[model samples]
Target: MTSNAPDSVERADVVIVGSRCAGTAAAVPLVRAGHKVVVLDKARFPADTLSTHVLVPNGVSELKKMGALDRILALNPARSTHLRITDGDMVVCERYKPFDGIDYGICVPRNLQDECLVETAREAGADIREKCSVESVVWRGGRAVGVVYRDPDGEEREIHAKLVIGADGRRSRVAAEVDSWTPYRGSKNGRGFAFRYMDDPKAGTSQHEEMGVYRAERTVGLTLPSTPEGRVLAVWMCPAEDVSGFRMDPEAAWQQKLDGDPVMADRLAGAQNMGKVRSTADLSSYYRRSSGPGWALAGDAGHFKDPVTGNGMRDALKHGRLLGEAAAPRLHDPERLDAALAVWERGRDLDTLSTYHWGNRESRPDPVSDLVREVLRTFAGQEGPDLSDTFNRARPIEAIVSPTHLVKGLVAALRRPGADRKAIVKQALGELPLEWHGRRNRLLDGFRSTRPTKTERPDWTVGNAPGPPSYRPAADPAPVGADVPAVAA
Candidate 1:
């Protein structure tokens, strides 16, 4: 073990990597609690990344807690009270109900959102160093003690701390260095997305606050109102195989596709493209181990679901706050801190699993069955809080899309003139089923199973020393496991 004697090395109570929503959110609570916190990020602030900018009411609540909601609202983000979606000939407009007095969603761009969060953390006393990249973790006595990083000038430095946090996005370096294993990984949907900002005065109708989605046979179009008065975001998501033609001549391809779509064409008639079309193809989803002896992973560093559902920002904010709450009180005791982190990690998986599966089903390139269409139609026509709950994320997804509902919808579809019984039956039985999910997970475990490579393993786990004690809590924390599965593993 390295000596703890005073040296030129800097130190803190906690060292957080990645100063985006997740990292900044976690730092807020810890620093406010009087802990010496330092946040490191590879990029400078006020930067933007590829993202779906919708924030559901649940996420708005987190922003409220951090005192960033008011500042976000000042950015002129369009307030959305409902979601408008269409499938075939059916169109559903579901309104969002108020949650704790927050009745709407917002479309704050990442540039504004990330800046606000990092600034908030700074105000709360967190030392944020931008242009600093963490190269690896430093270990002492089988536990993570610090990190080795390159400063802005490319000078290597060591910073010691009791705990290290990974808030980096999907390809998190901290997670790799700690040997975090992915227990579940969702299959690719073979879909790609191209989006651009636009100056469309008439993009939205009915309400100033609503997300408009149009669905055709194999494509989906979205019109999201952004901050400025006449600005909006227009996106088209389609099969990966179909994206190449669109990429050939982006402007012509985008306009052609828009004009061809039954719904989107009319709404964007006079809209002028404000920026170059940005495209993304590889968007697979997965969940990684959240905590180890003295290290924890938060936000996308640990779990990422498809962006089709517009849940990425929400998940990052919610999980970051939960992690902060869980770890703040136990930072001084390794055993207790690890236990708390384990609970938070498990809860994150259980809470997000249903949505993860839902996104995969929704993003598939295959056409929806007649039964599925009817199910959506039926839910849209219903008059009650259920529809609101569905759109606002107040209810568990299973409650909205249950097996019983599918069976009923299947029966209805069977009566349709051109219903393909085989396809509908196959979809009803196979798509989004829990059993199917379990099977895929088992299959992935086999394909992904292997001993950690030297570069990916921790110091203790990398060397001959027996691997760090099983982080799986020796005694399950009763409070944390009340509703989660036996083990997230």
Candidate 2:
């Protein structure tokens, strides 16, 4: 390891690869510790990412922790609280009113979001490099030492640091260099695909009806509560095996299928193409066999569950923070670096498996969907809360995105003012189960994972899917395991 003499000629205190949510999240804490940090990535900021574009309240809180909430709120894309969706029968369920947290997270384009944090890291004193791709891991006695990357100009450089962090996306360059990955699991654990679009907003509606199938049977799409009007944002997930056809005529196929969609068809009528549809076909899940030996993995490097949960970005943030905290003290306790990572892995593993299990099980829920309808049936005309701070808390997205169980799902469609609880009722058809608390997960327990292991996805994992219009934590330290799951992997 290099000397930590404040200004050592040999290296940085930390080296992070990739500058997405995970990398930036880790950079925040590291910079605070005064570590010389270098964040390397192949893509520059302001990238147009294919994400659903809805930030959960918890994600907003994380931004606040990183000192980004103020700027974000000022640039709010659009805040939505309830979701109005029509069944195959053309029966529409009103929005789900969040009984607890912000009805919806402010929706900003992914490109803008990436730029926000990357700039934050630089302001906090991190060396930021774009168009830089890592080549391999530098090691000393099987322990990490630094990283080797190719600069944008195609020149190779060696960066030696005490702690090397690999926050690259799903196809992590660092993970490939390290021989410590476990399979993503079964058949479902293979490649997945996704693509994005800008959308046209309906006159009076703001909170995007980010929609998923009752049990995630197949297609996934959502109309985000965002800007650059006349463009309707959406995404569709498919297996990698079928990507060949989709890539051949991405825009055409996307337009055709979406225009053929019952709900999205009308929404897209006024919206034109804001950008070309892009796809990330290799999206899948995998975990490091170990997160030790002086090296650590964050974000996609550690796990890659399907976006069916809308938690990848959130997982990256939470795990990145945890990894950063564990790595921070290492500048002073290099000998215990391995131990610190072990703890991070244990906690993160449980968290990832829990989310994966539920996400996969929730793939197609016709039975439980009925139960959810029963729940939304409970909060038809009640105003949950009315404070901006109350809506920005880091609560679980379950209450906001419940499956076939559309009660709390619609009733809890928490968003900013414009449409009150009564208006939300007039707009939709169902609710997420209230459970004296929030959405129910028991019906989805078994289906979470194809393997159905206890370790992967647990039962009643997180309690009461937080209420709408109150995203702020009623308590502190961020809900432990309650509302954080929607954002976590």
Candidate 3:
């Protein structure tokens, strides 16, 4: 194939970069709506990516809505129906509440999941160009119009489109080209992560279909049933500062970490390790501006949170579809398209802000304090809504464990016989600073603006758009992780 001349640029209604979850998802809706959709990715099908790979019920719903769930099911991935969380001697176990008729989580490997999504988009009429690298966005009159890319054959080509969507990962090339890579709000992730697969024929079977999460002094571990049947994904999360040591001897470090935790050790007993451990230390969370005049960012390209919550895949699918739906109807009318994109961005922020902050707090590399443990015990004993609902997005996280519950748990701990009253009081007092910071940040977020300012551009034209609405936390809200005892469900 020869490079196309600049004057012979190809065209499309929507050109999307990155063919994984977000990009493929966005393509389905647009192409089905009768638009010419082009999706590009630098990798071929069945390639792997760094991910925890757990999809809660809401994520399953998203897959079904996109018409891809059946394909995923055919892969024989394990269905996780229950969740178990352990901290010290406190244990909370519960079945996942049904959401949109979905009652289970799926832990499909990224290779299968992304390839399934790409196929789904292709079947829906999107032209998917694998192994195509996007070099830059095409600019005309201050708004994006298309992309300049290198095809797998080493031929350069141009695609001019009414809208360009960036569904690339955290370090999105499209976002960088559009100047939307800078996050407006962010927090340093406190933990590092590592995982590997194991042979577990009993996984996803009777009495073993539950996802296990174990929290120790400064670490967290997870056991999730995964694809190809009879296999499980084992994970370990520790302080970010400790990730370097694992790089030297990942096998030994992973084994030592698992052996140190009796719960993990028990779960992995008799299981055979499948390969070398995979690890990542760059888990910082943030929110970036999602859209502008002619370009939009979806998935981790726009917003990312710590993997501790295991909600990234769900958000990626849901928001990517939402963005496509929002833009499809107004593609011919640039003004309406821009307005719709802005609205979608605002809604995305409002929907995910709390979880973003909660993920940050949960990723902290501190031991679970006694006060928090007591609250967890109380919450486990008397729970109104199923904690699983939080993961399903059926209920707000704050509602799972309210401020009243926190106070009650504290008082109950103080009343227990032989309790260390002084230490309990001291622990509660020590949490005041964190609580104050959470409250203050919530307040400030409510008043802050998200609208981009207008400026003259020498390279292109500009458009006017409305600013996003402020985010207000629920009244008398508890600090991010203090009330949410279950790290993940």
Candidate 4:
């Protein structure tokens, strides 16, 4: 694993750093296309990490496309078909309908989920190198062509590739080395998360599966079933100031908080704490520069939004695959590849910005305003868009919160008998400010001209590849160092 001789230099068509959802998802497409792909991860398999870990229907669909959804469900995850949200006095429950024969969200633990995706990539002919740390990006004349990594033995080796991908998490070393700056950084809310796992066999069944969100005063709690081990993740996202006290004695405090909510408390009345409590603070959302000369960023490495919306997994998995498909056709030419990646980056921004703003509002440490409460009351069975669509990102934000929709909703509220005109006025003022803030950013960003002028077919890169990527279906589908046709329209 030395670089002293040309023959000794480990080579691949694409070298992917980080083997979680993003890196593995990206590698699958290239490997299927018969490209030589090497995926490197610093961590060993079946390791745990902090994640909301709820896969809404949108996320499930992406896994389905990769043929991994069934495998995930085989782990006996609770299949949720409805979401029940309790916002102060108003209660709303909406059922989930099937999307392309798939319904329900699965909450697989990150450790098990990451293993499934990495194994999927291996099945498709990608070489997965675990416990390998990427020390630095290998740059040549301003373009990244490879990386310097340390294997598990702590021996340094150089890997050269036609393209290098940074699928690492939000704190991406690849992005840092490339100076990939953030164009927009969203506001940070004072909210922090404290989570714990429990054994709850009676959480719900598939036919009656449920996800519960309760917002009382300034505190919010989420309870969802996760993994085959009969574990459910109960999370409390409260003001940052309250976290230290909870951290002192998490189980006792968590139980106390749950006791305040009769419904959540009842569901967990007999459940036993399975592990120690974990917490995270200072959650800020932002989008980073996604692509440059020879390297492109995917997943959290490229862009990350708040986890409040639970769309991180979908974004990471879907966009990683899209990026790989986009680069497949133009991998040999840095110019075309960069252009395609630019297109992918733009699409990613457009798709996630609305959710990003929504997450900011959710993550805000301030008490849930009456105005926001009123809005949530409307997102129900009788009014507003389907809760699943709004929360799961099945539809764009424009569908739910357009100017026309807002005006109509306001008028409807004002017409109600015994309406508090003063409260209505305050609601409008409070909500519109954040809406305007998001609008201003979007407007400014729209005017910024970026990307190459030349346009090649971009749609084909989105899972529209010519055929099955690999020559075979199982492991080692292609011979070592196989080269397939360049993806083209």
Candidate 5:
């Protein structure tokens, strides 16, 4: 916790930008391994940010491993052991199966959750500088060496380090400076999100201990019991085309959408709104080039998925910690550091590809088809793999709903009396292309690697250097189906 003099040049083994989930998670591991780690952020702790706010069991496990779980639990956030999902006329309610001996999910706001992580990193011996803004990276011999930043006192300073990591979120300044802002694979999201808090009188009741999800035509609603007794977070996701109407009168729109879902409407009948509605329509998903000489990207800085899956925070904590663990031992050797970063990047892509596609499918504006409803009904009645395992990352999502399982569900539905066999067959035929595409992506990504080829590395020579691309969000957001070209394999 020592501060350097104003305008002085400092040095460290690793310099991390952004001190929230990913940066702090990385700093804890590096500092505990005896590396001189410096973490910087423009905002002070206990600050609010847009978030899903739900931590699946695996994310809670990461916090426990980092020794921050006790502090988080002290906040007294609501704990959910049961999950209830309602899609059209189908319903599935089940208790979460334990993963690594942990069984419940908790919803704590970012302000409290992030502060706990920051304190944990600081306690592990990382120098964390709040209200510090990094302006650009310093380069020498075609490699990143450090960063130029403005400290809290409005004085400009510099810090040289053996490795620089970007944990800064989706419009990351670090990612821009390193020329890694352009995503290699990207797609526009079909859904937009709006959320707010409510005070539920039945908070401590047994029914309130369950997390509820209602999926209706062109919309999805979530009721997650959150922190501060009697408070719950209500989230609504609607088709992108509906965002304009929502932006015009948010309160009315929020109420109207919730009322459209009978199940969610009944649950919140007596609840009181705690705040004004908050929302965003910029929910595109992408994966940027994550690593290069002397530099790397962690968390949303390098990859992002639509929040529909509610897995963003979990991946951020897990991968950020893994990045530090992989790079700590190789920092002393320039070549080894770069190689290690490339390896980590590849592993992360391989791990998340399935969920990325799954999220896109879940958030689409299409109405739930009869075939899909039957599939879910079949899954609910059967004795098989626990679907909750997909959320906890204990098993891949495809394993739970494989092609074989889908066929079995369809066959069972056809055998039912009064079934419209002709219509079901037609709908199943229409879905084959999408189903095949998803499976093909998983198979191909398994054999591919993220290691850079000779031409992929930047040519940082004096005259050949390219200026950083403007990575800022546009003034008017793009439409839902905007064209974004994907890189060829």
Candidate 6:
């Protein structure tokens, strides 16, 4: 598409790039608050991604808050769950309950999920334009004033707005449009390696079902919910550069590793090749800040993690909600925009930072992979399924470091061989270090932050626009395009 014609001067309260989870979620909350929102995306809908397709419970909750939980459930993506951690011949499932009741997350194809959400934002009155690439961010007096984008018709156009948001994914063009963002350089998001297909029938499988992260000592495989014919599965990793072989022949690379490992190979049996056997270099990464003057970033644009935690979409949803709530007060007062975003940053920074580091930890297994698997399996029944979160959060490390608090743990270890009780505890404590304890959730003397969930009137809709944006680009040329300093306030 071209640029926005010189004749047209578009107006919006908020303009967002990327229309998946973060952009859509941000639009909904702002639309309810009566903001005129425009969501621009460089790609069309129903796009495929290197995703495991699982929505963690927290991811589900945020979608629920955005009024998408029921709709998502109705889509009937496979609902299978529980992590099944296998080490050699032993299989153990450890459940990590951040809250209650939900032991597993939901699984849906990335294409279907993104499409559903873009449509939802449309219903809520967001001017969603697909296949439109943003050229640059327009600035006024050194502050973000609007955006200059290449429209679907291959024309250039500018959409004036009170604020511009980088809802774009990890490698965001909007983020590049900002000055402070320059110092951040490139994106912190890692590369993602994944492949999916309908499960081959010959694996001697049970009824069609979706399983959450199934981790072995060296690799991880995930199954999405069952499709009409079968289930979708993907084996992915976020390795630190050295495991660079995946960028070449991913299929061969994956095969070599999976085939060498008996457990992972078992997970791949009867796996039919479906779509593109590719990798996404722009997996999620941690960002320095969330907002600046007249702009804020959400979802992968803000922060993302390796797929090991299976929380990218979940983080997007939660962070988007927070962004919406932050922008709410600013929508009316205008003067409070910066302040509001600062509050939102304060509310989310710690949690996301903690999650990213944890995700990095899970990207690759440690030296004692076999022993770790044994310990997890031995305690499987008592814990939930899937040790991705367990491993990522290093819950086992916490248990060992504080052995005095874990009754029966020594006995449980004693039942299994190659175990040294006190020595193991000492090793764990030494590895954990003392500084991290400061980040642990502490017993507050008073109360938690009382942030309201509903930042605006739910009855409002951003999708109420007369029609979707089909901005025609101009034949002529026009060039374009935040300090994230210490939170916005």
Winning model by lDDT: 3
Q: What's each prediction's TM-score?
A: 0.86, 0.69, 0.87, 0.85, 0.87, 0.75
Q: Would you list the rank order by lDDT, best first?
A: 3, 5, 1, 4, 6, 2
Query: Candidate 2, 453: how far from true, in Å?
Result: 3.4
Candidate 1, 371: how far from true, in Å? 1.7
lDDT of 5 by residue, 1-489 (tens): 123324567889999999988898888889888999999999899788888687778878888877788888898878877777778767777777665677888888888889988988898899999999999998877678899889999898789899999999988899888876766555567788988888975687976777777888779888888887778888888887778767899878977897788888888888876677888877777667777778888999988887877888888888899899988888898777776777777778777877777777777777766677777765574323366566667666777677776897688768868889998898788667656665566555332223222112122111122312223223211111222222122
lDDT of 1 by residue, 390-483 (tens): 5467766767766667667778777778778887777667654543453343333232222232111121211121333232333333321243
lDDT of 4 by residue, 1-489 (tens): 123336787888999999988898889889878799999999999777778687888788888877687677778776767787887676778776566677778888898888888878888899999999998888776667898989999999889988889998877777666655332233444577888778875754542366778887677888887776467788888876778868798868777777777766766677775667888764556556676677888998876666778888899998998888888877888777766766677677777777877777677666665555666666655523276676677776656666765776677667767878788888788777677656554444452223211111111111111211212212211112232223234
Tell me how far candidate 2 lies from the true structure as C-alpha RMSD in angstroms: 11.1
Q: Is candidate 1 or candidate 6 better by TM-score?
A: 1
Span of ten consecutive residues with least summed lDDT in model 2 = 461-470
Please, what are the lDDT tens digits per residue for candidate 3 over residues 1-489?
A: 123337788989999999998998898889989999999999988899988698988899999989999999888778988777888778777788767798888988998888899988899999999999999988876778999999999998899999999998888988778765556556666789998888984664654677888888788898888777778888888998778868988878977897679878877888975766888888777666677778899999988888888889889999999999988889998767876777777677667765766676678788877777777776474323376666667755566656776787788779878889998898878665555444444434432233221110011101111113222222211121122111110
Note the Cα lDDT for every prediction shown.
Answer: 0.72, 0.57, 0.77, 0.71, 0.76, 0.58
In the range 173-259, model 2's lDDT, one tens digit per residue, is: 776566434332321323345456555546355434333232122444445556543344566554344456568887677765565
Candidate 3 TM-score over all chains jointly: 0.87
- Backbone clashes in each candidate structure, one number apiece? 0, 64, 4, 3, 0, 34
Instruction: TM-score for candidate 1, please give it.
Output: 0.86
Alpha carbon deviation, residue 70, candidate 5 (Å)? 1.0
